[model samples]
Target: MGDSNATMVTEFILVGMSNYPRAQMVMFVVFLIFYMATLFGNTLLIVLIILTPVLHTPMYFFLCNLSFLDMFYTTCSIPQLLVNCFFRRPTISYTRCLTEMYVGLFLGITECFLLAVMAYDRFAAICNPLRYNVIMSWKVCFQLAAMSWAGAFVLTLIPSQFQPTQFCGHNIINHFTCEIQALLKLACSDTRKMEMVLMINSVIDLAVPFSFILVTYGRIGQAVLRMHSAKGRGKAFSTCGSHLVVVSIFYGSAISMYLRPQGKTFSDHDKFVSLFYGVVTPMLNPLIYSLRNKDVKGAFWRLLGKKMSE
Candidate 1:
């Protein structure tokens, strides 16, 4: 019986990105630099936010959480990717693969909720400026953040507890990282129910938050339009521009990855899309926030000047 064929797999061979043997070293160097930059950029942002009293507000508080998440998010996949780039036949133990998949999924879903909360912060700041402080107080901010993290962790745990029976004897993953969809391909058992579960999970974790962000931004747009002064509009736009850009990139890649028709063969296109969110996005986030944010730039200089004086 097919059930008997589905024995436990001890390890999995990861096919990674390129089949060209000569490209390995080049890929390794590129990804290594990306990993280092991701670490440095996110860590620097977190430290700067903490040291500068100017950034102690709710917006920066969420940004700090975002920076922290970015650090861990990339760590869940990038280091393993770098290592795989060097090995001709890269492999991972079953437990490690599942751990990576679970962590990555948790962080990714948490980010979705966090982005939605950030949009609400923007909405409050722009549409209800008179009570922005009262609305996004420290306690409320903490609760929103806590809920996002706790919800994502709990949701991922439910699925992890009921792993696909099809994967029992399977051991080959076509991607560098232990992506959930990639791992799903190894399952030999019927996966219709599992796929349906994943689809419902995606609807909850991805679609709902994305819709929330859109609605919040719709209110923000209305508020911005009602402002008579061009200066006021510009100020409001500047405040939210970085977050909007980040949301566009993240949600765009995520939707492309998860919203596709299921049961089709996973392709290199999917691998590259995963690469964008898993590796490149984290590295780009700090740069996007810091470059566009004058407050962050000022805080960076202030911190630098104080260090120099010391």
Candidate 2:
């Protein structure tokens, strides 16, 4: 009987922005533009890094990974969101909904680990310049990137296995996507254990990385002050400052959504918060890095000039 009840919900209706009928078309246009820009920016960055030998350093390698992650992250949910914006009643099958939830979870956790790895890279570069190359060699970079993906896989897979597999008759998801919090609200089974799992995952995936980044920057700050060369300090600050901004934007919105008290009813505020991280942050990442970093700008112009000359 319990299993039968769980199997009852075959599809879910996504409320999305349907509540604001006047804004649906406007939202659709805005999101479409954001989505296009995200793909173009991240994709261009990835190609630029690969083609420019100067960008073959460990920092850009990690950046390449981040670019790819951002592209995938936005692709996972935004297209569905755009399509749903056209309909008054948008629906998704159970299988796809769960798939989206798990995939988003995996990518998000991977990013948490990846960001910490990037911080360590920055720390090593600033604090141990002589050994920077040795410390962040291609082999080490590969290993760190691999470990991030693997760790996120284990973390997402294990906790997800313990979550409820069945939802009660209610199938309306208030948010645009099958966000875990919204999905959990529909579950017929007791979700206390599931919420506990989410809380633990949040600490490991959100709080830990954020704290590590803060500490890493603190050490970098100390190293910068010790430097006698203003030029060198300026360079370090330039690089680290861009990364810190990215970290603040990504982690701030994410922590607010995931680390908050569990079991509270999901609200409009929560949806917008998720939007900031999921849609806004990814769109902003490549722009932030490329605009702030001289290397990226030079590489882009160089590539363009070469093509034109040919």
Best by TM-score: 2
| Alpha carbon deviation, residue 31, candidate 1 (Å) | 1.0
In model 1, where do residues sit more than 4 Å from their true spots? none
Candidate 1, 67-97: lDDT as tens digits: 8999999988888887787677788898898
Q: Report lDDT per candidate.
A: 0.86, 0.91
User: How far off is residue 93 in model 1, in Å?
Assistant: 0.2
Lowest lDDT sum, 10 consecutive residues, model 2, at 1-10
Clashes (backbone N, CA, C under 3 Å), per candidate, total 3, 0
Q: What lDDT tens digits, residue by residue, belong to model 2 across residues 218-264?
A: 99999999999999999999899889998998999999988978555
Error of 1 at 132 (Å): 1.0
